[model samples]
Target: MTSTPPSPDAISYFGIEVPFMQHIGLRPLLLDSDRCHTLLAMRPDIVNSRGDIHGGTLMSAFDFTLSGAARAHDPERLGVITVDMTTHFYEPARTDLTVIGRCTRRGRSLAFCEGEIVDTAGTVVAVARAVFKLVVRQPA
Candidate 1:
C-alpha cells in the first residue's frame, strides 16, 4: 500500500493532525523552507496547578514545532525523528501561545532546530533546541 504525500496546505504536511495536537488545539499556520509557525489556544485543563501553561506542554509544543521546521527545510522530504531536546523556560505563560521554529543547520542525516514560545503580548515564555535524525525510506 502507498500513501500520498500530504498537500503543502494540509495540517498533515507538518504531521500536526495527530490526536494530541488536536486535543491541545494546536494549529499550524505556516510552514516553509525558512520557518514554521503554530498556534496553541490556551485551555484551562492544559494549565499547571499554578494556572499557567505547564512546562511539559511547552516542551511538547517546542518539539513539534522544531520538527516541523526541520522537515520543511529539507529538500529530500525525508522522515524526521527527534533525537534530543533541551528546553529553557524564561517565563510562565498565561495566555494563548504562538510557536515559531527555524532550522539552524542540516546535514546528510541530521538536522538542528530551535523554537520559541511567545504569548499574545509577544513576551518570550520558553525556548528550545533540538536535534532530529532524518531517515530515508526504501521503496518496496
Candidate 2:
C-alpha cells in the first residue's frame, strides 16, 4: 500500500540519529492538520518475549510520535519532558504496526496527547495518553 509522505516538520523534529527510533526502523508516515495528528510506523523486530511487541517499545514509539505532533504544531524554541504516561494493552502486536498520536489539548506549559497502536491487520493493540511539560529554550 502507498502511504502518505511525512511532513517536513516531522523530519525536522525526529533527527536521523535518534538511536531508539533507528534501531526499530521507525518512520513517520503522515502528518495532517485537518486531523490534528501524526502517524508513525515500526517494523516487526521491535518485539519482546512471547513474540509480542514489547509494551515499553510501543510506549516509546507513542511518546515520540506525540512529541512530533506537539512540535509540528509549535516549532519555535521549545523542548518537552514527559510528566506522566498511561497505556492500555488491548492485543498482542505480531506484525509491523502504526501509531497515530493526536494532541488533545495544549496549554502554556503542558500538552495532553493520546495515541493508538494498530497492527498490520488494523487491530487496535494499544492505547496511550501522556502529559508533557513544555519548556521554552534559551539561546546561548
Best by lDDT: 1
- Residues 7-106, model 2: lDDT tens digits: 4444333432345665555676665531223344444566676778788888888887776655545545666788888999999877778888887888
Question: Each model's RMSD to truth, in Å?
Answer: 3.8, 7.5
Please give the lDDT score at residue 40 for candidate 2.
42
lDDT of residue 96 for candidate 1: 96
Off by over 4 Å in 2: 1-17, 32-45, 138-140
Per-residue C-alpha lDDT of model 1 across residues 21-135, encoded as one tens digit per residue: 6666778888888588989989998899999988888888888888888878653445678999999999999999999999999888888999899999999999999999988
Q: Residue 35, candidate 2: how far off, in angstroms? A: 6.5
Which whole-number lDDT from 0 to 100 does residue 2 have in model 2?
59
Q: What is the C-alpha lDDT of each candidate?
A: 0.82, 0.69
What local lDDT does model 1 show for residue 23? 62
